[model samples]
Target: MLDLVSRPAPWHQPIWQQLTAQQDFAHAYLFSGQPGGGKRRFASAFAAFLMCDAPEHGFACDQCRSCHLRLAGSHPDLLLLEPEEEGKAIRVDAVRQLVDFISQTAQQGGRKVVVLQPAEAMNVNAANALLKSLEEPSAQTYLLLISDQPSRLLPTVRSRCRVQPLGLPAGTEALAWLTEQGGERSREECALLLQMAGGAPLLALTLAQQDALAQREKVVEGIKALLKGQVAPSRLAEQWNAVPIELLLDWFCAWTLDLLKLQQGAVEHATSADMEKVLGYMAQKLEVQRLLAWQDWLLEHRRLFASKANLNRVLFLEKALVQWKNLLQRR
Candidate 1:
């Protein structure tokens, strides 16, 4: 209803065409992709199209009554369901509400659209409650489920919907798009940002805007000082506590992988080019097996952090820093 399909992003254009070309659609559809890959944007556009009174070429006509209501954020037929709080589970009560909403006919006398984002946040009971609706959705009702980690969803829930996986755009396309998004980065800078964001265009733009490269530099310098015994693990952890634990762990994971690559004579593929000398020094001073073990630990902690586990953040960082320091002693 917002005319989102009017000017589609490069990666979403094909998906728009595919959706528009289809006259018939499944009751439930799951759009799955990595974080920052634009799956949610695509799903929102698809939802808009479904609710439009006069959709033209998969895009909503903004002049239509339905489009006006949707643009006003008062579309009676459009419902959005997500976790009430960040990193919290979607309870069965929310799913029960959605069930009741779907039971009613569309107020616009058109399609009723429901969007559930980050579908993995639904608890087991909530997911189970939603299964019946997915299995047998009412006529003229559409469910759009968006998830960055579909594997966390129940098999039965996944099996009931048509799944579509979105992938990252090409380097040139992504860079061009990032530039358009006010990134204003040179080619090398754009490439570095893309690498740091794992090739996700929107995320690369966000990282560039947030000066994440400078943040990573500080993190690398902290790790180097900790490993060299110039800074105590406790002190470093205190300093890094200001940063998000998830981001710090991600940087640590990348740095450890870069050290491993250096040890394996794969310097070209190392993540941090500016910190090559420091990474090389660590590679030479730390045992390869110990570095690999540290890598495993970092990955495990990162997974825990992503899942929002209630762990002691300060102690976690201190233990990781201490382990890293111990790795240097083993040489």
Candidate 2:
């Protein structure tokens, strides 16, 4: 549903102007930034603009044939490459498909745009496959690779492309975006998502709509169960074992850290009232140093889980809680 109009104000205006001024673009351009900050929308709109037969000042004419096709989600040149379903990484096979597509003549013999998002998600084989395409790109084909973590991409891939990095909009700008979304302007929710999402507006919006009301209620219930000290860590593990470790860890980090902040008389920002309950309980048992140590442990575990490996997440989380719980018991 993202388009030019719906894009964040800063991105919608500036990038369009720059691309408009370009006489001819390099074959490979990289768009890297915090997730949800409008990189994908900019890519799509740029693609739409390039294909528009009658563009308006570097903007797409929604009524044009190409624009219509794009609006219908059927543009031939508007290809999006991504990770394969059920697989954690983008495959070499998918890169091959993109290479083939970009090498061919455009459906209408105009410019073609290929967008590969979260390009950092590509594995070694996939990155290598893409390198060949970039090494000798088609004359009229343009590649836009979007990435949240540019460091994850191969240095070779990074070198071939002109990287454009997006940044967080100022508070005033972000608040304007939230107002457009028709929210009551809760800076707590806004700041939490912004911090976690790494400054991506779209990501913030998506997380904001995560049926958080329900998920938050569940998280509160889970914390309450754990606080009772009667609930076994194994039982708690079982409840959340199947969920992605990153999800559980991230929620835990935000939920607890905010409370520690509030207890210190810092401005109570970002933590929902539901999060306060767990915070209060934790503050009683955990000194600042121990709480921070536990947070670091979870963060390290999160990184390991994201890599090319399998782990017993349940056991890991259980072990982590065991230490924290014992601390509570001792005190």
Candidate 3:
């Protein structure tokens, strides 16, 4: 069974209550938020509430037959639409299927709901196909669209729905939630995870579960070794074969930003403790123009990674590292 949230996260409680108390519901909702900020969970919970046969106090009645079906992942009236593969575009055929689903009467004799996540993943053709459903509201049918980057979505598509934004939770609230979900993780570890996640509790938990901290430590150590001439960039790139390229690019981008900030005297302290010294030394040695040029190159490749460009990961990493190290060389 899909692990649907029973209710909104604590940070979303007020908005949940407000939405539940509404007299009229929109036919579609666009839930926009950062990843791990509970936008999907909120959308799922709202879908459940919409389909609940016997909603109690603005929440799903778990005892109802409809709730039972949902719990078993066999809810006939509900559909989930997303890309077949991760990081791939949602095809027009899938949106066509959604259009067909929207036209059909509810099998459960109640509301029909569709949850389409990462809505920005829809290509032009797919998004245009979806627009038809948005233009003509089907009776007792609702569509919940979730996106981490709503700006990437078509303006027409975004304008059609009631846009709901979910912000990152307060630091203390995030820390508390992460602590509770962290299992054996110490408070300090959870705090570090939270920092790494940019105060997104669910993401912090996910990173912890993935042992991302250990992975980060390994990468940092390899960088130190490479800088000290103990390891070649090619060797380091090969060593990091198991690490995700997107994550590596993200870290590099972040480090580049930090280096820029330090060089410009924009901040007195480094935000990343693991690379404080490394970034500090680079900031001192590298010219600002060279660093800016490197940042542009890193960002361009990062965009390519986001677009799922078919470049060799090993070669990319080797090239990235060589350029990174060259930034410190005398002009």
- Say which candidate scores most in lDDT: 3
Q: Mark the regions of model 2 whose C-alpha exceeds 4 Å error after superposition.
A: 1-12, 183-199, 228-245, 255-293, 307-320, 327-331
Q: List the residue pairs that clash in candidate 1.
A: none
Please give the CA lDDT of all the candidate structures: 0.82, 0.72, 0.89
Model 3 lDDT tens row, 101-151: 999989989999999988999999999999999999998999999999999
Q: Count the backbone clashes (under 3 Å) in each candidate.
A: 0, 6, 0
Ranking by lDDT: 3, 1, 2
How large an RMSD does model 2 have? 4.0
**Winning candidate number (TM-score):** 3
Model 1 scores a TM of: 0.91
Identify the runs in model 1 with alpha carbons over 4 angstroms from their true place.
Answer: 1-8, 227-229, 266-269
Compute the lDDT for candidate 2: 0.72
lDDT, candidate 3, at 245: 79
